[model samples]
Target: MSAALPQVFPHAGLPARVTVYEVGARDGLQNEKATVPTAVKAQFIDRLAEAGATVVEATSFVHPKWVPQLADAEDLFTGLRRRDGVRYPVLVPNPRGYERALACGAREIAVFASATETFARRNLNTSVEGALAEIEAVVARARAAGLWVRGYVSMCFGDPWQGPVDPAAVAAVVERLLSAGCQEISLGDTIGTATPGHVRALIDTLGSRGVDPARLAVHFHDTYGQALANTLAALLAGITTVDASAGGLGGCPFAKSATGNLATEDLVWMLDGLGVYTGIDLPALVETSRWMAGHLGRPAPSRAVQALTKD
Candidate 1:
């Protein structure tokens, strides 16, 4: 059977290539009610790499008490048969988590931060400034060890408890991450309430604060059915890196209203139509997500995956 593909229609003023950071294994599965086996997580990472994902977030090193779904972090990382030219980054929430990631030989790591105080307190068990302090220490030590570090700022667009976050406030967090030696920062719409204009305005605000758009990545949730539109806005604003999950499979564990991430297949379909290079095979990616959906005992939430896979 022949596979379906998007008709290319090049859009001007957009990047020729965009990096799709695959987060299914880590962020996507972290919120699951049932535990995904360690071996299955390893296989999922391998499948994502086979489908041409250059960067895949493997697992989180946070304590098992916080996120039990990924408690097999050490085993998963140890057992993973890594592919060459593919980068696998792990999340570290504090010094203890960083030590665990370092022990697992992670080459790249990410730290999660919150732009609002309420989110910080709820997610990180600290105030916004306090979380930044911890993240600063982790990033500093990781950089010293010659590992590449990425920073994630959650609730950049809106907070469930504190609605409609200010762009300036998000930029402040971005500045702190940059100052702390993070190579890149992903701005997350945790509750998915952002629109295209808000995305553009936030990028502009970050730029005005002397932060380059190149160092920024967008992580949008599809709660408001606006993830793709907001992503387009980010692309037009010269942001080339996008964070997506394989099956639209992740939501903020701390924030009840935040939905699944912008699906990888859906994002790839859009990029394919736009004539932007992502180097991922759309058919293979769809198949991988379908396989993962079966493991989860649920249908994939990605519209592209659903439409293309329907027989």
Candidate 2:
């Protein structure tokens, strides 16, 4: 059984253990210009699980028209190694995608809704309410299949077209996803413009709406170099789950100007030093990122990985 890292002392108002939700294989690679081979993607998932990632999102079931890179999701899931305790969830936009994910043996699924109507239209060609309506059905169907459901609220903080967002608006979508039977909601900082104060306020808003921090996860981007700081705020606000991509991979496809995700390696390093257990193998994780970075023909963006692997 996995154990929490030993707490050296009492951490006032901080969680003892945090679950790092690794999205490297799915969220990390979805936006890449070069399409990764099916075999390579499977290998990456295996490596992530071997590095002690209990929840590794593998691939999305979205249509090829939306993300052609993950067109081989079925093939990737069919022959990949399944770790005993690790969960591999696929993104499903609608019922058709959910059905495809189910056929590929997916036991957990994720559906995303946007906070702003503009992002809703731009990302999925639907209004916020319309997207939530579709996700509700997907969640209901997946729950009926006894599959775990995760929901994502995109553009939770600020949007490119619609500058500055109301926390209540984000919470409204989150509530709809939860009412549809999503066990957890990931509030996504799609444009990477959220600050620590913004994160705290958003969490407070959700809390005020009867949403516990336990059922929430923070997904941040490093576009303005505030991802880690914002994450610290979430941790202080009692958030236990964090969504990160290995090697800091991934950028918003809809919001092209945004930078990559907050690197898992960087988050792990901070948590380790803070005595917050994540059960991740730091050196092994770094090695995997370096290897994956080599495949991308670039140096790893994670400072932790680069520092640990520096010549």
Candidate 3:
């Protein structure tokens, strides 16, 4: 049998130090109605780094018609003040997107695939197998170019169009991603419909398949107000990395009723209060979230910000 995972992760007992990948600048702002200026995006990155995000997803190289807000991804990456140890990863949808990211000096990149056939067809316009074949080429090329790659398996917990997703199906895509050389795989709760029970079962099942918990991460949207609870489940499953958006800024545009992602400020606050070192400055994080909210003509969606700002 695989080595027994620590009954109580000392890291957790001593307050786990989770790595939070800030996806606000890219994932959060992508679906916005207003076009967030490239200069604004650059400043946002600077502030996110200052607030202690070691890895910030800066932008996507998706087509303009799909996400016009981030059409100037090249400009956004080019304008950022590059920090020595901090990573600025961008989402590259295909080979063309990968080429654009390389031109802009992207040191790390992310690609996405879905678990359900319906989502694969609807989101990527291909079957699950076809999409994986294409992603294999992309990942191979990216690795050859010496770029760090991350894989996203969306709708892992459940799908709106396809109903309940199979754990075996989730594991199959994860295996493809890992085999294709993605250093880390992030399982996404795309529609925000997952419960803590589902999160636990999926992690355990993936573990049984020999997927190291260390290389796995969770991305949950708080649509049903269960993101934090699901995060706790991930910790129990020995996952230390998570994907959160500053100010809870994004949702699936296809799922109109969906809510924004789990708020970074909120997640950091909980981690900090528990003595978990997220390496993020909570006050500065709140300020950045509020700044983005103001820029978008919306209010910050983080409860921690509301509570902290109220006093």
Among all candidates shown, the one with the greatest lDDT = 1
How many pairs of residues collide in each model? 0, 0, 0
- Per-candidate Cα lDDT values, in order, are 0.94, 0.90, 0.87
List model 3 lDDT by residue over 189-262, tens digit each.
Answer: 99898998999899999999999999899999998999998998888778989999999889877566568999
TM-score of each: 0.99, 0.96, 0.95
lDDT of 2 at 121: 96
lDDT for position 123 in model 3:
83
Q: Candidate 1, residues 121-238: lDDT per residue as tens digits?
A: 8888899999999999989999999999999999999998988899999999999999999999999999999999999999999998899999999999999899999999999999
Q: Is candidate 1 or candidate 2 better by TM-score?
A: 1
- Show pairs that collide, candidate 3: none
Per-prediction CA RMSD (Å)? 0.9, 3.2, 5.9
Candidate 3 ranges with C-alpha deviation above 4 Å: 1-15
> lDDT tens digits, residues 156-237, model 2?
9999998999999998899998999999999999989999999999999999999999999999999999999999999999
**Ten-residue stretch with the least lDDT total in model 3:** 1-10
Find the 10 residues in a row with the least total lDDT in model 1. Answer: 1-10
